[model samples]
Target chain A: MNNQFKKGVLDLCVLTILKKGDSYGYDVADTLSGKIQVSDGTVYPILRKLASDGLVSTYLKESQNGPPRKYYHLTDEGAKKLEADKQEWDVFTKAVREILEDEDK
Target chain B: MTKKEYLDKLTKELGSMSYNDVKDILSDIEDHFTVGISAGKTEEDIANDLGDPKALAADYKEGMDLPKILEKKTVNEKKPKAPEPTSATVCFCVLITVFVAIPAFFSLLAVVLTIVLSEIAVALGGIALLAFFWTFGPFKATGLLGGLALIALAVFGYALSYFAVKYFVLGTKWYIAFIRKTWHEGL
Candidate 1:
């Protein structure tokens, strides 16, 4: 996939994942890697974007691992935006797929 | 850099920004990290998700704009990005005159003056070279010729110094013009 296209989708993917539950940085990296072949570093910038836009809030939770882990919780605004985005993505991808498939015939 | 390290470096580099803006950027970064971690990602993995640092920085720069950055560069900030070229040239010329050129010129003149004065005191420096070979040392043609040569060299040295002062003055003028041109172009 083109890197730019992948980036455009990245923030949406991150927000969609966060819709599941509050998560720390490490755990989020692992989960996203399983679903998509992507660089692990990309998540931080997305998280930065969401937080900057007031889409999420975070707090530090004591971790058994090494340092205190920061946990991110989705704000109400984030949840509403995520819902709209997922709806749009479903229609957009399905339409694109239909067009490409019809071209094969 | 890792996610934590990236944020730290950015914070340090952007020390001049308002605390609130920095805090907002940090919180957003933390949120992204938290989301990634909850998905079971490693710190490196999470950092990778952010994409290239330079590209990200450029995006931030585009959004904030350099004018905004300069606005933040207050008078308190060290070296307030210099004034216009003409003004800068004037300042530079002034500084050079006071610190370097003036001292250099005076010292040079002093040395030349000392040589001239000493030559006058001894009287044998320049004028003695024209001495006659018919006196007590009539057979010492080589010695008399050497003395004349020495006198010629001393006079030549003093004349060279006069040109030095002239060049120094010309330099200050060029410096001022160069400064003004640079400033005008920038404006």
Candidate 2:
């Protein structure tokens, strides 16, 4: 699979996860790292990107032990884009899957 | 490797990004590990899941396009430039432009009028320049030129503010201080 395909999906996956509800930066990294391996410190840069572009808003919430944890909430803009990206991705992936299956035949 | 060793490796690899950016990203990774541990994953388990620090840092090194990553750091790099021209700069600029340029452009008056108002503005500006020096016009301790320029402005401003005040009024504080010292000595 194209690495671009994987990379594109990582952002969409992040937006998708946030679409359900807000989550802290670490939680998003951990959950996504389980399904697809990311680097030791990759998720943060993505979170910062999404945030600086106005796709997310971060707020500090009290943590169990240490300092207040920053939580990333998907903005309305992010949610709308996630819906659109979901449509585009599904169509794009389905077409690619069909092409691969035809090659198998 | 320990977390500090891992972060040091990341910092070494990502020399292009600011160190604070690298530090924030490292904190995010540490957060990932902490959350993973809470969820019943071992240190090794979490570490394995986080593929490679160098490769990940490369994903964020401005604009690195690989097979699967968007790597759009430059796309977000302009956020830090917002605080450069703060309010003090704006006010100081307005003060200088209004005070300096308008006075310097008085060429339309007849010979006598031109000499008089031009002399007045120039003379007053020159005196203000002196006071501007005495007051340490700008607060820049590190900027020699800026400090000097602002000191020039400070004199200009003082001349502009108190240009017409009589020498008697200006010396009142000195008189009071001298009287206090003499009277205290007499007592």
Q: Which candidate is the best by DockQ?
A: 2
Each candidate: RMSD: 11.8, 22.3
Give the whole-model CA lDDT for all candidates, comma-separated: 0.67, 0.65
- Give the TM-score (vs. native) of candidate 2: 0.51
lDDT (tens digit, per residue) of candidate 2 on A1-105: 456657778878888888888899777876776677565355776787888778889988888866677899999999888889899999998999999999999
Candidate 2 local lDDT, residue B107: 32
Per-candidate TM equals 0.50, 0.51
**CAPRI-style docking class of model 1 based on DockQ:** incorrect
Candidate 2, CAPRI quality class derived from DockQ: incorrect
Candidate 1 structure quality by residue, lDDT tens digits, A1-105:
577767667767888788899987656766786788765545655675677688888888887644577777899999998888889888999999999999999
